[model samples]
Target chain A: MNDQTLFSIFFSAMVVNNFTLALFLGLCPFMGVSARVETALRMGLANIFVLTLTSLAAWFLNTYVLENAPYLRIISFIIVVASLVQIVEMVVKKIAPVLFRQLGIFLPLMTTNCAIFGLAIFQTNRGYDFMQGIVFAIGAGLGLTLALVLMASIRETSELSDIPAIAKGTGLTLIIAGSLSLAFMGFAGLL
Target chain B: MRTTTPAEDFVRGIWKENPVLIQMLGLCPALAVTNTLKNALAMSAATFFVLTCSSVLISSVKSLIPKEVRISSYILVIATFVTLADMLLQAYAPVQHKELGAFIALIVVNCMILGRQEAFSSRNTVYRSLLDAIGVGIGFTIALVMMGGFREILGIGTLFDIPLFGPNFEPWVVMVLPAGGFLMLGFIILGLGVFEQRKKSREAAAA
Candidate 1:
C-alpha cells in the first residue's frame, strides 16, 4: 500500500500525466467547451464531480463484481458511467435546477468522454487501492479543469488576433493545444 | 429534405466530410495510437469493423428500440462489437493488441461510431448505413495513415520501420510524442484547408 505515497500519485496524475494535455483524454470537450471560459469552468467542475464519483463506483465494482469476468469490463464500465451520469443529472435537476441547467447537456456527453472511461480502466490497470484511486480521480479532474480553463482563456484571446484562413477554427485550436501540451511537459520531472 | 446520391454519401466521408480531419469525430485514436503505421492500420481496421457492423445491426433494429433508451441500446451494441474486435485482435495480432491496450476498448466511446448510430444508422436503411460507415471508416483510416506516415517518417526516420530517409537522418523524437500528434494534425488540417480553398478558387476562375 505504501509503494507510492499519496502526494506523488496526486502530483503524477494531476500534473505529470495530465488527462488532457498529456494523455489526450477528454479532448472532444477540451476543444469544444473550451471556447468560453465560463462553460469550460462549468464543464470542468462537473467533470470533477462526475469523475470522482465514477472512480469510486468503478473501484468498488471492479474489486468486488467484475474481477472475475474480465471480458465484461468495457460494457460494464460504460453502462456504469452512463447510469451514473443519468443519476447525477436527475438529482441535480431536482435539487439544484440552476446547476442542472448549466450542466445538463455536458452530463450525458460525459458518458462518452474518454477521460472518465480511461480513468476507470487506468485505475484498475494501476491497481490503486480505494484511497489512491480517489486521489488519482481528483488529480485527473483538476488536471482536466486546469487544461480546459487555460485553453478557453487562450482561445478567448486568440479570437481578437488576426489568424490566417488555413488554420482558423480547428487547426488553430490544435496548434494551441499542442503548444500547451509541450509547455506542460515541463512538469515531467516534478515528481 | 434533400437526399444525396448513394455514391456521394459513400465518397463524402473519404474527404469532404472526413470523420477525423474534417468533422473531427474521433480524435483520440487519430492522436493516440497513430505513432506507427502498423498500429494505425490495426486501429483503423478495428474501427471500420465496429462501425460498419454496428451500423448494420443498429439500423436493422432501429424500429424496435424505443426512443427513450436509444442511446443506451446504441452504446450496448457498440460495446459488444468493440469487445469482439478486441478479442479478435488479441487472438490474432497480440502485439498490436498490447500496443493498442485501452484504446481498443475505448473504441466503444468513439464519437464517430456513436454519432453514426445516432445520426445516420438509426435514421437510415441498413444498406445506406453500412455504406456510410464504410466511407467514414475509410476516411478515418486514411487520415490516421497520413498522420502516422508523417510521424513515422520524421519521428522515427522510417515508415512502417522501412528505412525511408536512410542512415544519416536524425529522427525528430517529438513527432512520436503526444505533442507531435497535435502539431502534425494541426498542420494537416491546415494543409487540407489550403488545398480546398485553392481548388474552389481555381474552379471559379475556370468558370
Candidate 2:
C-alpha cells in the first residue's frame, strides 16, 4: 500500500485517470457548467473543497464507524455528503456573500455531482491513509477543474464559429469532450 | 396547469421528456458502463428498479413528509432502494457488479431518480408517479442500449459477446474507450436533432 507514493496518486488522479474525462464521474457539471470559464473555475474550486471534506468524512467513517456494518456505506455516505453540502452552503453564504452569489445553485448541486461521492468511495476502496486520501481528493478535483476550464474555453471560442444546426448544443459539446478524452489518454504514458 | 392523462404520462418519458436524451438527467452511468451491452443492460435494470420503487414509495408517503425535510427524506428513500439494488447485483451478477463498481452506489445521486421524486412523485398521485417512473425508466434503458449497442458492435465486432463481423473486420478500439461513449452519444443526439428538424419542415410544407 505504502509503495505507491502520494505524488503518483495525485498525478494519476489528475491526468492519467481523470475523474471527469476518463472515469465519467462528474459529467453533469462538466457538460452543464462548462459554458463559461469563470463559472467552471469557481465550480471547480467548490468541488475541490467539497471533495476534500467528503474524503475526510469518508476516511473517518471507514476507519472507525463502518468497520462492521459495511452495508451502511452507501446510505451513510449520501447523508454525510448532503449535509456537508448544506453546511458548506451556509458557511459560504455567511462568510463570502459575493462568492456565494456566484456559486449559487452549483454549490447545492454539488451534493449530487457524483464526483464527490465517487472520490469518497474510491478512496475507501483504495484503502488510502488520511494524507493519501486528501491528496487523491485534491488531485481529482484539479483534474475535473482542468477538464472544465479546457472545455469552457473551447466552447467560448466555438461560440463564435458558425456550426451546423444539427451538431449544435450538447451534441457538439460531447464530441469535443470525446476529443479531449482522447487527448488526455496520452497522459497515461506519464506513469 | 393542464391535466395529462395516464397514457400521456407513460408515453411522454419514452420520447418527448426522455430522462437521458431529452432532459439529460442521467449521463454518468449512460457513459460509464456502456462499453459493453451487458453492463449497459445491467446498469439500466438497476436504475429502473430503483427509480420505480422510489417513485412509488415517495408518492405514497408524500403527505407524511414535511416540506422542509422532503428532499432529505426523498434522498434517504432513494438511497435505501439503491442499496438493495447494489446488493442484489453483487450477489446475482458479481462479474458485472465488479465492472460497474462505484457506479451502482453512485446511482443514489443520479439526478434522474431524485429529480422524479422532487418534480413528479412528490405531488402526483401514486398511480401517475408509477407510470411516470416506468416511462422514464424505459426511456433511460433505451438510451443506454442504443449507446451500448453502438459501442459493443463497433468496439469488438460483436453484440452481447456474439460475433457479428467476420474475423477480418477491424474493430475501432476507440469505440470501447471512454472517449467512444461521449462521441457516440453526441452523434446520437445530433441524429435526433436532424430528424426533428426534418419532421418540422415537412409538417410545415404539408400545412
Candidate 3:
C-alpha cells in the first residue's frame, strides 16, 4: 500500500502530464464539443462528476476484484463504468435537468470517453490507492474542465474573426490545439 | 426494402464519403499509431476486423435496441468488439499490442466506429452497413498508410526500418513526435481541399 503523496499527485495531474493538452487522451470532445463556452463548462463539470466517481470505483474494483482476478479486471471495469454512466445520467436528469440539457449528447458519451477510462488505467499504473485515486480524478477533471473552458472561450472569439473558409472550423481548431500542445510541453520536466 | 447492392456498399468505403480523410472520423488512432508502415498495416487490419464485426452485429440487432437507450446499446456492442480486438492484439502481436496500448481499448469510444454504427448501421440493412464499414475502414487504412509512409521516411529516413536514406541524411525528429502528427494531418487536409477545388473546376468545364 503506497502512501498517498498529495503534492506529487497534484503536480502529476496538472503539469507534469496534463490529460488533454499533453497526453492527447481526450481530443475528440475538446474539438467537437467546444463550439460554445457554456456547453464546454457543462461538459467539464460532467467530466468532473464522472471522472471522480470512476476513479473511486476503479480503485475499489482494482483493489478487491482485479488484484485477485487480473483476467476479469478489464471486462469488469467497463461493465461497472458503463452502468454507472447510465445511473449518473439518470440522476443528473432527475436532479439537474438544466445542466443535463446543457450537456445533452455529451453526457452518455462520457461513458466511453477515453479520458475517464484513461484515468482508471492511469491510477492503476501509478499505483494510487483509493483516496489518492479520488484526488487524482478531481485534479485531472479540473484540469480537463479548465482546458475545455479556456478553449471554448477562445474559439468563440475566434469564430467572430474573419477567417479563411477552409481553415474555419476543424482546421484552425487543430492548429490552435497543436500550439497549445507545444505550450504544454514546457511543463514536461517540472515533475 | 430497397436493397443496396453489395458492390456499391463496398465501393463507398473506398472513395465516396470515405471516413478518415473525407469524413474526418477516427483521426486519433490514424495519426498516433501510424509511425511506420508495419504499425499502420497492423492498426488498419485490427480496425478492419473490429469494424466489420461490429457493423454486422449492430445492424443485425439494430431493431432490438430501444430508442431511448440506443447509445448505451451501441457502446456495449462496440466495447465487446474492442475487447476482442484488444485480446487478439495481445495474443497474436505482442509488440503491436504494446505500441497500440490504451488506443486499442479506446477504440470502444472511437467516434468513427460508434458514429457509423449509430448513423449508418442502425438505419441501414446488413449488406449496406457492411459496405459502409468496409469503405470507411479502407479509407482509414489508406490515410494511415500515407501518413505512416511520410513520417517513416522523413522522421527516421527509413521505410519500415529498411533505411531508405543514406548515412548523411538527418531524420527530422519532429516527424515522429506528436506535433508531427498534427502537422501531417493539417497538410493532408489542405491537399484534399486543393484536390476538391481542381475537381470542381474540371466539372465546371465539363458542364
lDDT tens per residue, model 1, A44-111: 88889889999998888988999789899889999999999888788778887876676555667888
Poorest 10 consecutive residues of model 3 chain B by lDDT? B101-110
For candidate 3, lDDT tens digit of each residue in A1-191? 55658777876786556788666667777877898998898888888888888998898888777777665555666777788888999999999998888777778777667788778877876688877888899889888887798889889999789987667666677777666666767777776
What are the fnat scores of the candidates, in the order listed? Answer: 0.70, 0.82, 0.22
RMSD of each: 1.7, 1.1, 2.7
Colliding pairs, model 1 = none
Candidates in order, TM-scores: namely 0.96, 0.98, 0.89
Give the higher-lDDT candidate: 2 or 3. Answer: 2
| Candidate 2 residue runs with Cα over 4 Å from true position | A1-3
Worst 10 contiguous positions by lDDT, candidate 2 chain B: B1-10
TM-score of the A chain in model 3: 0.93
Candidate order by decreasing lDDT: 2, 1, 3
- Candidate 3 pairs with clashing backbones: B13-B135
Q: What level of docking quality does candidate 3 show? A: acceptable
Task: Score candidate 1 by TM-score against the native.
Answer: 0.96
Q: Which digits, one per residue and each the tens of the lDDT, describe model 2 over residues B1-207?
A: 539999999999999999889898889999999999999999999999999999999999999999999989998999899999999999999999999998999999899998999999999999999999999999999999999999999999999999999899999999999999999999999999999999999999999
lDDT digits (tens) for residues A112-163 of candidate 2: 8889989988887788999999999999999999999999999999999999
Q: Let me know the DockQ for model 3.
A: 0.42
Runs in model 1 deviating more than 4 A are: A94-104
